[model samples]
Target: MKMNTKGILFVYTMPLVLLHESYGFFVPGYPTKHISVSPQGKLLSTRSIPSTTTKPSLYSPSTSTSSLALKSSASSDDVQSITATNKLDSILSKLTSAFPFFVLGSAILGLMKPSSLQWTNQGTLISWMLASVMCATGLTLEKKDFTNVLAKDFAAVPAGVLCQFLIMPLTAWAIGRTFLLPLPDYGPSLFLGIALVGCSPGGTASNLVSLIAKADVALSVLLTSCSTILAAGVTPLLVKVLVGNAIHVSGWTLCEATARVILLPVLMGMIVNAKLPNLASKVSRFTPFASVVLVSLICGGVVSQNSSMFLSSKALLPLIVGSVMMLHCVGFAMGYFVPKVGLKFSEVTSRTISIETGMQNSALAVVLARSMGASPVASLPGALSATVHSCLGSILAGYWHSKNKKGKEESSESNKKDFTDRPEDDYPELLI
Candidate 1:
């Protein structure tokens, strides 16, 4: 019985092997004549088999088995390429997953020893680091990706952008006025910092958060890119209009700085990607990881620099913390629900917009705050805001990730049940 079963298996598989070999010669542009070694160690020329014939029998030994071998070799190369791409994608995903932890660790270390990372406090250093972050963002983008997302849903981008500029800055102003402005000494500087946080563009970090949250990552990137570029014009204007009395700010200077640090770097990266995609891809593989490190350093530097102020203002720390947290929470809630209620967008798009709107480019805000000659006390909010938003975003990401996993499992189970209910003969081609 075992010998009979073995014979049956060989009978079934041998036909498939022979059919595969015969089909290889019929491939378009393949040479009609190829040499193969038969079981008898004789050279078999496959020219006897007609290439135009639709059906070739396995019994025909005239097949060019060499062509089959060549096809198999090509398939192996394709599999290798696919494996490498998957490995690269996995590495990038891991980096994104651990982003919040890196930010937190750096902040803690900076607070513990303010002098260690003090070199990062220079205005020039901060500006260049920010430009690098923007450049990394640009490397990930393509012209078609943006156009595709925008063309698919025009309302989403515009609405999100409007919310980003409108909601965050106004929230910041209200929070500052209610909480910080009433204080005696640090009121003006603190208000200025908080206002700057509100006025700034959607952060690059939001893109990573969106990815983790299983939200619309493409939309997140587009929103961040658009807001960052427009920030060159809009951020300074908002500052001038809203907080001009508290702190003297030159809109023109701020605009120039925004252009220099944010716009130029992003454009340069886009140009590189267009011209040399292969090079850009290689560089971008590392950018996500690099951006996390850069952000951590920027946040850590702020904490280190302001450690003294933070200690002295322990009485007001809770208020400051509460105000920043409230500002972000409001931004997140409004960003999510506004479109769901007003524009009637899907939950995913709304989530993406919420993240983009809630998370401000606090690093850029910190740079602007210091460069514009704001006091260290004023700059503390941006630093604290950075840490606060990262934690909140990470928590939100964890929730979304688990929810998405559960949803996928349920969908898979339903699909399995459907497959089981179907008759086998209904998919005759699949049976082969």
Candidate 2:
């Protein structure tokens, strides 16, 4: 299985590299000379004089008033444009920070009326939505961000990853055995799903959540990728040991899915950003809010599709819910305190580890669960996991964003200088 997975990784990687290079070669997103940067560093377009008219130099005495007037008008226009743009960013920032509410509402809506989100439950749409979210994450990143992770934050990778495999899987097995009442009568298969989720690597969504929370997004992405690569060996071994020989998952196939859903989309987004920085910056302004929406939809759609499975029993509801909820909360708590208190890392780095540890590849869990040869209902735990982890991560992001903003405001008032460097446009911070 390991060898096969390696083969698959090689096949997928070659094509992906070619495609990324092809895109960069064909669409080098070069900025035009007409593009101008305002004093505030905002991009603007300046029109050239007509061929029939000679453009007067600003130094010429004859056009001094005209130049002054033009400068005044242009400055006025720039102010209006910047004001409008900032206002839009402020609105998006509010909305993005409130995404926990949106996600929670979506989950509730999906549970109540599965038919409403039923159309979006298709496999292709789900993949595309997830890809789009990941792409948005990639757009926010630059090559330097990754290099920083490699240089500074590389050591933290194994520490946090250990928490994922060591803590979550064992905790999951214990919880699954304890909480579930065996509703569907396929005990091992349902338990297998639970175990699989715990053993799964850090979610691709972690990268997006890290960005939103103002955590170490570059570290989160690196951790996620590293964990995924390790999952090929660790996942199967953990399942075999914990669950005692369930139907095996194809690690190569898993890698292929991940490459399509995560690696490729992210690389493509990065390529676009590197090639067309101006275009990327313009598009990035809207991506954070868009990602929140798509994540809500994806989670809600998963719940909607699996609504009947877990909801079939009133008794089963709390059992499944309580189990998964407890598992993720433990994951989040342990993930947070371990890095925060034990390792004595910065708050931001610890938070990044917390998110990466908390969010699992539940979609991968769902796919593996389906092959368990148990009833389709066995996949419910993985589906429920998606709702639980995403909601938790979103809430964490929302809370952290608000707290970070409050701190910035206090600091700015004391120092009399707005120091909030709005990094990567995860959300726009307005300097009031």
Predicted structure with the largest lDDT when compared to the true one: 1
Question: Candidate 1: misplaced stretches above 4 Å?
Answer: 1-89, 414-432
- Write out the backbone clash pairs for model 2: none
Q: Compared with the true structure, what per-residue lDDT tens digits does model 1 show for residues 1-432?
A: 122445434533443354355332211111123334334333332233334543322111111211122222246776666556555554454544455556666666666667766899874887788889988878777888789888988789999999999999999998888888889988989998999999997687787678667788778888988898899899999988888877688888788888888889989999998998878867776787788778778888888888776677677778888999999999999999898888899989999998998898988888888778778777778878887887787677667666676675566557555655655444222100
lDDT of each: 0.74, 0.65
Model 2 poorest 10 in a row by lDDT:
56-65
lDDT of 2 by residue, 4-90 (tens): 445434532443354344322211121222334444444333333332232111111111112221132346776666556655664
User: Following a full C-alpha superposition, what root-mean-square deviation does model 2 have from the true structure?
Assistant: 15.2
Tell me the spans in candidate 2 whose CA falls farther than 4 Å from its real position. 1-74, 181-183, 200-244, 344-348, 361-379, 390-414, 417-432
Q: Could you give me the TM-score of model 1 versus the true structure?
A: 0.77
The estimated TM-scores of all candidates read 0.77, 0.67
